[model samples]
Target: MLHGSDTKYRMFRAALLRGRTWLTPVCALACATVGASWFIADTMVERIAMVGSVLASASTAVFFAVQLAREVNRRNERLLALAGIVETTGDAVVAAKLDRTITAWNSGAENLFGYTAEEMLGQSVQRIVPAGDTTSLQANLDHMLEKDGMHTYEVKRQRKDGSLVDVEITLSPLRDLSGDVVGISSIIRDISERRQFEGEREQLLERERDARRDAEYARSLVEEQNRHLVELDPMKDDFVASVSHELRTPLTSINGYLDLMLEDDEDFPATQRQYLGVVRRNSERLLRLVGDLLFVAQVDAGRISLEMTAVDLTGLVADAVEGVRPVAEEKHLELVADVEPIEIPQADALRLGQVLDNVLSNAVKFTPAEGSVSVRAFLDGTHAVVEVEDTGMGIAPEDQARLFDRFFRTAAAGHMAIPGTGLGLAIAKAIVEGHDGTISLASEPGQGTTVRLELPAQSGSTESARYVETLL
Candidate 1:
């Protein structure tokens, strides 16, 4: 890995040694010729002696001349080889004096700058440099001279066509035989394509940065919106609870007065009594709707308080089946109840009753004429299991997913014109989950519906409604 200068210096020293070796033989021949000249002129010994001294001087001169010629020939051959290399190289090779005057232009330089040697030679090197940027070229030359070494940098150069090209320039100071800096030789390589690619890469990186910033800003906006929703949730629950309470008071008074009026039917006409009955029924429905709203508000506000107790699932299931039996009979639907004694040591009897009532009522209400409703209760390991199945026009798969969502009515119910507030299953789910129980429904379109309720039979497994968090 010898440097350029180091290799050149070594070669020059080796050539000098070889020249001296050849001069030695020539020096011997010159001495012999001088001796022969001196011996053949014995008659004129004084003249021969002076002639011999002159011949000796001549021989010495000829030896020095032959050595100088060999040295000059080797230098010329080296210069020719260097010129060939410079001309054949792919990169531009330019030689210029310290005054920035171009001296040599190789073929590579011609191809790069669209200029011939005749056109560029003796011209200011500034011809190829970008206008008004000659300071950089001068500074580079000054720096190379100061350091006496090669320096490389990137710069823009102008071609003959007025187009600009990015180039990497390596400027090496050329030295004369005395090892003094005489000029600067430059190797120029086209890097326009490389710099263009780098520019595009930089643009892509900048775009990526902008996209990341936009994503972060979007995330911050979402988080801020979520915070506002979190703050407004309590206010929404309070409003619903207040409205339900106000409605319930008026509804209760209306129902009481209607009951008193309906008891004495003789005081009114038959048509008037019929109207009063309708009012009572409508009032009851409204009251029930208000109650559901209040309950839901309580659940939302985390204010549910359960009265836990040891309860028998067997009696509970029987009572729920009986409550829905009249409705099933009205629809001409068969109602069957199968019970086995199953006890839950800890539960809210009121809430458990509410859950059972909701399931059984829905089973009977959705069943068509001549369809059957079956209620089953049994002890399965440590759990009390209750299942209410109905041979009804069953719920669609899509609607089943949202059956326990408050105020979400099924398409089947809407199509059938069935009357409901859509809050029954939701309330039942909240109450069941409060006691650490699970309730599920299985149904397919036109098949049937099955509701399964499983509760822990042990006392310690259940949580009071007040402490429970209803995920629904």
Candidate 2:
């Protein structure tokens, strides 16, 4: 398995030796016969032998000449094929001398530069190079001359029509038989369209970067606004707490005087007594509203402290049902209580009671005459569960989601002029959650409402609450 170069070398040597093979042997034989004929005194035979030797030498020379001619023809064919390829290639192929004078130019070069080979041959390569770029071009050529391989660069060149063309040129050092760099051979390609495409791609990339910058700026603005809101939340809570505390002192005095006036009917006339009753009722409502606001403020500020202790949930439910019984009786509604004794080992009894009272009162308040409001208390797994189900006018689906939002009143309650501050459920939820519990409601419009309270049997300690506040 001879390699390509080895096989060609072997074939060339075989061709060179083909004429010498039999001719060398024939010449040797003729000389031997001539020497033998001289001993036998045959001059004619010697002369014939000498002529045959001459003929053999001439034949050998002719054969060698024919072999050399064949070798030359093969090399010329290979050169013709290379020339055809260079002539037909799409890239401009040009060969220049060390002096920067053009030696050969292909048809591609002609098409690119609008100059035929006849017109460009022997001309200085600088003729096509833009005047502003000659220094850079010379530097590249100098580098190619110093190096052994190829050097490629982009250049702006002028065509014969004086139009600028973007070209990418690869310059390689052309070597002679002795392996010395003699000239440079270059392959040039027109890259105007490629340059245009690159420009468009860069523009698109820049636009994308700009859009990303704008989005980042918008996000930063939103984040800043969120930070401001977070800072202002506690301030708003503080303001509500301060305002409620300030109003509570005056409200308490007004309610007390009104109660005193209403209780004493001898000093006050009938009309005066009625006015005092109205004032007292309105004053009590205002006082309740202020208490609710203060409680909500404390919850939001994470300052609502709970005294955790073991307590019977059954007793709490019973008391809460009794507390709301008078309101249910006033509306002629039935108040039913089903209590199963369950002890919460760790809980805020006061807060838990408050949650129940809020829920039961709401049940009694919303139920119409003869409607039943059922309160159930039991143990569910590790939790103490309290459910208040009422045959009241239920909340709409849209309103149900925000039922526990502070100061959010339902449309039906507002239209009916029901006495409410809408802060009951919100405060109840805060109290329940502060004691490590959850409160949820399920209701449908015109159907009924069910409020379920689930509290952890073993509530979190004060230290855990402090840690939660710190996180907030």
Candidate 3:
């Protein structure tokens, strides 16, 4: 039995169809009545009156019949056009009875659901609905009945193979001739590709968010480490300063007493004299080591003072070369110098001497027997250039990167048992930079090394002096 609303729709359809079925019979009866009225006329006036009345009534019925036929033809043409459109369209067009029974299925529906019209017709609409979505389908139907109009929504529908697809379905009411809704017509569009693209876009956004979070976390860690280093730097400087001062006091006294005993060594045995000399030399070395440590600490604390004076840079290089030449001679290494007499307008002659001494000393100390060490000084425009080249065991590629870091010894130096504190180049760098100068080194393993220094020829202004002082 149909529901109350379904019964009403069926009754309205039946009454409307009965009325249309009787229209032609009524027209035929009107024609028969006109023929009888003409045959029964007796007098001339009566016959004319009957013919006129019958003719008028027959003409009215004929006009109505023609109008009805025209309206029916127009409606038939409209239905044919709509059917053609539904069959050819890409979107699925489906028609179902109010009881949810499938009535019509287009080619599009067959292609989308993998089911032919023959198989779907007379079947319940739930045949294509997923198990989880049956309730939703009923709800949609109820909503359509309540609204009494068209509605569109998205849902997942299962194909004949049981695979689900995303679809957009628009449901519209199908009405009878008496304007009573008896079925539902649905237009379904596949939306699988759009849904897939949206899913990928969301995943990409989530990945980008994760990357941003990781980057922020790394930056925060780096900042925290830098703060920790800054806090520990002062404590490190104080410890170095205290230790150097304590060592230097004892070292000075040892050197003084050793010097006195070495001078009077002839009064003792030769072995004792030799022992005293060893003690004296070791004391001097220890004292020098302590002094270098103190200097490094002072530089770290920005306590280095420079005494600016006009001086000849070439003369300074020449003096340092002479001082280290003895060491070169002892190693049987060739020492050479080329100075092109250039003067600096304002510089700390003493500090410049220390930088040159460190560089020249390293050259002489590292060169093998018969190897060559050369020093060159000249003026390049407004700058003074000094270059030192040595045919020594050159630094390795990896070690050259950190060659100027304090106390950083190279693998090659350690292997060869070369004596050094590794503070010379670092100190030289600080002093050269204090004068607003630049220094660079180039070397290759087993080949040679070249140290280059470029300093401003003239920086005599008071502001320049103050700026240079602050650097150290």
Sort the predicted structures by lDDT, highest score first: 3, 1, 2
So what's the TM-score on candidate 1?
Answer: 0.69
User: What TM-score fits each model?
Assistant: 0.69, 0.64, 0.72
RMSD of each: 9.8, 11.3, 9.7
lDDT of 2 by residue, 7-74 (tens): 53345344433322111212123223322111111113233345445445344333433445466557
Deviation of model 3 at 38, angstroms: 18
Provide the lDDT at 183 for model 3.
94
Each candidate structure's count of clashing pairs = 0, 0, 0
Better of 2 and 3 by lDDT: 3
- The lDDT of each candidate is 0.79, 0.77, 0.79
Give the CA lDDT, 0 to 100, for residue 95 in model 2.
97
Error of 3 at 287 (Å): 4.2
Candidate 2 scores a C-alpha RMSD against the true structure in Å of: 11.3
Predicted structure 2, TM vs. truth: 0.64
Q: Per-residue lDDT of 1-472 in model 3, one digit per residue for the tens? A: 1122665334433433233322112221344454422211122333334443654655543343344445555666788899999999999999999898999999999999999999999999899899876478889888988898998899999999999999999999999766999999999999999999999999999999999999999999999998998899888889989999999999888888877887887889999988888888788888878878888998999998889989877668877987887788788877778767577987999889989999999988888888988888767889988899999999888999899899998998898899999998998998899999998999988898999999989433332211100000
Query: What lDDT is obtained when candidate 2 is compared to the true structure?
Result: 0.77
Task: For candidate 1, write residues 1-472 as lDDT tens digits.
Answer: 1122765334534444344321111222433443222211222224434534655635453333444445656776897898899889999999998888899999999999999999999998999888867588878777877777989989899999998889999999887866888888999999989999999999999999999999999999999999998898888898898999999999999999999999998999999999999999999989989988999989988898889888877667767777776777788887877766566888888789889988989888888888888887766788878888889889988888899999999987998899998999999999989988899999977889999998998322233211111110
Candidate 1: where are CA atoms >4 Å away? 1-95, 102-123, 132-134, 143-148, 265-274, 323-337, 360-374, 388-423, 441-450, 458-472
Largest lDDT belongs to which candidate? Answer: 3
